[model samples]
Target: MLETTMPALASLEAFGNVTDLLVRRAADAPDHVAFDVPADDPASWRPVTTAAFLGDVRALAKGMMGAGLVAGDRVAIMAPTRYEWAVADLATWFAGGVVVPVYDSSSASQVDAIVHDAGVRLAIAGSRAHADLLTRALVGTDAIGTWAMRGVDGIRSLDDLTGRGTHVTDAELETRRTLAGHHDPATIVYTSGTTGEPKGAVLTHSNFLGQVLNIAAAYREVVTPTGNTIIFLPLAHVLARGLQLICIASGMRIAHLSEPSRVVPALSVLRPTFLVVVPRVLQKIQAAAADKAARMRLGPVWERAVSTAVARGRLAEKQDAGRRSRAPRGLRVRGAVFDALFYSRLRAIMGGRVDYILSGGATLDGALSLFFRGIGVPVIEGYGLTETTAPLTGNLPGRIVSGTVGLPLPGSTVRISPEGEVLARGVGVFAGYRDPRHDAEAFVDGFFRTGDLGRIDDGGRLILEGRMKDVIVTSNGKTVVPARWEGAVEASPLVQHAVMVGEGKPYLSALLILDPAESAAWAASHGSTFATGSPGEVRAIDEPRLRAHLQPTVDAANALVARSEQVRRFTLVLADLDDHELVTPTLKIKRREVLHRAADTIDTLYRGAAS
Candidate 1:
């Protein structure tokens, strides 16, 4: 039976506005560390107390109001994950304006599209490069009125505005705070537009606050007043922003790291208990660990023994925790030895305090999810979209399964339509996009249509099938789901990404991008000679021998699919799907864009131009 009801919890009546929420927390925990900014130049870290954090937020709010940002005005912020990003986001809310976030990695065109679409009057860019990109994006257009945070030749700086403005009186700030209520639009988040032009999802303060309430209730057992989180995911994404609000509501300390590569080192230093990450990050970590294990050169027997022991240990741990049915004493001992030898080092690298790694943004590979679980790190996969305030369903502690995106969070409702598309409703749902036409198609019977095909299993787990838009119809009238095929292809060690084609064609085809390092290592090991070439050339090697190596994986994928959906032909591509242009920032493949760009190659593959 599906579990749709949640256990009763405390009512959410503390504050009505985001600013009020922050202020109340600050007053209650004035001396507690609210945020930590770790510097890369040295081993030093800068900490912000709740009082100081609120002080900065108030100052920025006053500064924004002084700069003529009135209620309902939109202020766009483009920055990496940092303290200023959070401060600016809250300040924008406190100033009674909507915050528009642009990912730091977004190109000039993307920035321009968001600013123009959201009708941003002011933009706060983080670095000189970001400011430059904004300038380039605004060139030949009058869409943006001003830029701040990072100084440009003519635009004002956030520091300058805050310094020049008079302190906002408490009463005045209070009035503005009250104006920023639940129903008022708080943010305009742009979807990553993998399919087409990005649409701004207009989310109100109520929508975000509802998500915060759901998250707090979902993790009430684990979340503490002193819990610390390492924030590295881009704040532009709703997932990160929603998590940040949860931390604020629960009074968790947030450590902001400037660089992505420094995440492991920062974790070692901070010893944070919680982390939020995408699937790609986990995939890379697993790959690195496997590479290290391979270098140990254990014989087949030894490797088999170790793997068996590790599996037994995991089963034993599950049984002891009462999560599994049973385990033998001898198997438990073998598992313990394997954990001491291999898993312990991995845990230490994660600072040994990480109790949960929240995986979201995209579907995580099931094998990779199980691998982390086997290592004693519980990875809880969740599912959400920008339009739904980030999380609609997530795995609660002790109830997580590898292949599913758990049950709906408290107060959220997810239903599978007769046609199998996922429909969701609750306070967490956004108040529609800014455009009426888009909003009209996004909802039906008051429930938000997620545009993804999925099923609510008997156990209440949400099993995602694939995007409705990504389904391909073969010439033989058989329906093919590309995502399932892509997932299978990517399971191969040789493949990094795959896009299945052949919609309305005779047979299925695929554009495959091989994993460069793995392919290179394989080539070297086999003593196969290739032209000394660029990374692209190395990745695009068509040595018949290389194809022979990948055939087994291709055959396996073919065996898993219907005969009509089987891949009849495939061409290895030389270039990756560029995140900046082809894929969404969340790293989801933009099938239409990729196929359009590689139209000729896809056609050639269908025509059997190259065998």
Candidate 2:
């Protein structure tokens, strides 16, 4: 067994509960701008001071108390990410209630499942529609009241809560806030795990405190007072929630956009210093830039620039590890030229000030990571699960390994089991699921079984392999780890998702989702039409042109493994998967769901091709 541990850089020994984070922030920097909400003009933002935010939390907490919210009651927040989500969340905490975050993308059934499972008594919705959604979802369950953040649809609201709080006193709120201990459950986050039902992961006050304090301490340069960020990822995700708490703990300016589609406009307006993104979004940004270049007839020049950037990135990482010398003079000259011509434009599009970006939720394509790093923005990769609050391991600034998930963050320990499963024991790790039945299987000894297979490199960085449960064993007993091949083939600019499928079959095959934009651009350049189809549809292409284009990716993936483990054939599954049920809210493609949804197509893939 291989293990590594990073000692805690900071702790909450001075504070008793999660409420103290905000309370202390207000005490130390009352006038500090905690958040920036949109002003009259959507482009402009108005700052909310720490003291003002604290007052709002206090008023809301008092209202909860008046509403008969006893300590330990669960208050659900069903909203898109916005300034109000944080207010309602903190207020619930202050009232000695557990916060239950409902993802914005949750279906009515999903909403119903979470509400019933978590024993939620009240919900704060983002709008009238969300309030209605909550109402509809709660039909069969015990009545759960709704409070809207914005609307005049006769429903109670933040203002209503403020009005009701006049009868409650300061001492009552204080007593409630301090009732929960450091390790008490702060939130019951229902985790959207792949191939399974959602489980309520009980992250405690100290779980977040340990995560936030250590992140701030270790990545000090990235979490400074002048730093700012835009939150577009659903606040329901533990990673985003952790980021929000970290920003508050470190006094970073924050702006929230309700949707990821609006992020480009928001980034240009907010000019955030850093960002946390899922890999697909990062892929879109890279693809968008390339498509623009192709449209401008700069495809050849742009291709050369990308190659240069990738080379520079690889060389930089090698140099950092002392495996290579500085970038040669010729490459340096080419890089400088590309910086002026291409990289600068790309940076300007991302608000020109974003020095770095953090990626989790999925594995970033290594080539994509190199390309961004080459262009002067470090796309750092982190690894974790809902059970780990956020990232248990993260790539350190300036010391990033292009393909690795970096070292354990401060206050965490990572070990590889004899069979290669990654085990974690950390302050950020949740104690157990709300349903304790699974706890016996979830933890081995003291370390939480990550269910992921990986290893630690010579320099102590974590490099993930893939999910142990996701391994595909063919009929002939050839064990194929699909993620290894899928990740490799997904590096192509036109491929949105590369899902390998050949379980209990003769040979391995793949189900691919080509990106609409990138594929359209490719077809246009290659003098062919881009086929359009609705989601959940499949087509077997016999076209020579498409085959030739994707064959290189297959060949590349094949080169990584033994002959029997290679993907013999791949077919297209015409899906965008943006809001598809097969995809989680965080954009994780549920492989089992996708395969089950497209079973016939996989059969066709095996019947039709052998190359």
Candidate 3:
């Protein structure tokens, strides 16, 4: 049985003012840097002192009020991660309007769906491109209006909003700010909708504030008030948005990066103390570093010797530094050398002072987690959803366990039902979905059912097993979970991602997407003839060769699963899953969609029709 210690649930009573939170922080740290952007070209950053940020926020809020946006009106913000995005979100709340966040890359149909669902009255787009996406979607909808951050055809710009600012008196502005309350709907964040139509999760100002407060208390022991963080993850997501709030309240400097490739460079320039990243970004960095190390031929003997010396230095420093319990001796040493040989360059790429990396959005591969720990930069994996305002549980710096998602955050309760689904009730929980139908299905007895299968161990760590909705049941009534098998298949050097399919079928099969760069290198090493082909041709020519290489991996994975759960066969995909279309923006695999699109190929694999 899992034991839960939850703080008394805070009341949803209104705080009666929203700008009060911002005003308090601004007064305390007026000159402290609030946000920075290292990736924006001219490659310069826009640094705002707390007072300046607050000033801009107030101006924007006043501007919205002058434009006739009343309390509870929905203002949609669709843009990439930038200072403007944060400013708009806060401004909406300050003006007592509910902010609806839409992804920058969402297609026309997706944009239409979200805007229509949220009943958005005025949409604020971040750039000209963002405005264009919305314009196409709002072709005939008169109920919705659009505003562009940059001036665009038939749309109002930020300048237009600021132009009307002089018409509003100080007393009028105060009234708008006073109308803002903690219980007011701050934002309606849409779920990724991997399984079906997306539903809007209604997060209130209090819900977001509670998340920031809980996380701050949880990591107060390690993170100092003077810490700085580089923000690259999408602010449209709850994790990134909540992190921004935490940074503000904690007096930490924040720098935003737009392009992912610029993360290393931005880090080098910012020298931030912390970063929040998804698993895919971390995996890419690890793979890149490993490839570089292999090419340099830094073999075990030299590596071990260097690692040992580095470890000793770290241990001595930790002893002198007078921190609480030091990290594992092996990890300390490996981190030291990794820092000395690799992390310095990595830090140089980041700007050098990163103290911690927070991982979230999906389950991180255990091997990848171990590798990151071994190298010395601790990657703390967290678990949450938009409905939970992002932080339900997290593995902190010193108390981390390799395979689990750590314990629940303060004031949060997590329970595993008889069916193994993780249910949560906490201060961070949202005010239910906007749709009554979704709200009914999403909650059971006041507990928000996560629909994720997981187990809590004797030590209280939460290990996520798989999604209840994605579990495959064979015709013989045997259950085969895709995540467990997919993790195993991905462990193979040749397989990048695999989608296991067997629901209502006799046995399991898969659609495999090979990692082009890794597969090509393996082909070259093995003296295979298809090493230099284009991505499509490489996949086509090397299918047989890859099939041969993956046989042992397949057999090994099968040993761990039941016969019905085992992958009976697989077909290599000729093209990568289209990031713009097939895959979600977060890079999560859409199983049902993918299976439907690849039905012919899947049928061929099961019928043994392909070579």
What are the C-alpha RMSDs, in order, of all predicted structures? 3.4, 2.4, 4.6
Q: Which candidate should be chosen as best, given TM-score against the real structure?
A: 2
Report, for every candidate in turn, its global Cα lDDT versus the true structure. 0.76, 0.85, 0.74
Q: With candidate 1 superimposed using the best TM-score fit, by how many Å does residue 107's alpha carbon deviate from the native? A: 2.3
- The digit string of per-residue lDDT tens for model 3 on 255-282 reads 7766766766566566778878887666
What TM-score would candidate 3 get against the native?
Answer: 0.87
Model 3 alpha-carbon miss at residue 316, Å: 15
lDDT of 2 by residue, 426-453 (tens): 9899999999986878999899999999
TM-score of each: 0.91, 0.94, 0.87
Q: lDDT value for candidate 3?
A: 0.74
Residue-by-residue lDDT tens digits, candidate 1, 1-611: 32253432434566676676787888788888888876655566788898998888888888777777788888888988888899899988988889999988888788878877777876788877788777666666544344556556666677876764476676786677679777889899989887767888889887877778767877975566777888888899898888888888688889876586788887788888888888767777765666677778744534554465446435634664477556577656665776776677777888888887899877777666766776777788999899889988888787776678988877778888787789988767887887777887888888899998888777787988888888998777888877777877786666767888887787788888766567667778889754554422213346788787677878888987778778977877645544577667777767776777678877777674322
Candidate 2's C-alpha runs over 4 A off are 140-144, 322-324, 516-548, 576-580, 608-611
Higher-lDDT candidate of 2 and 3? 2
What local lDDT does model 1 show for residue 323? 76
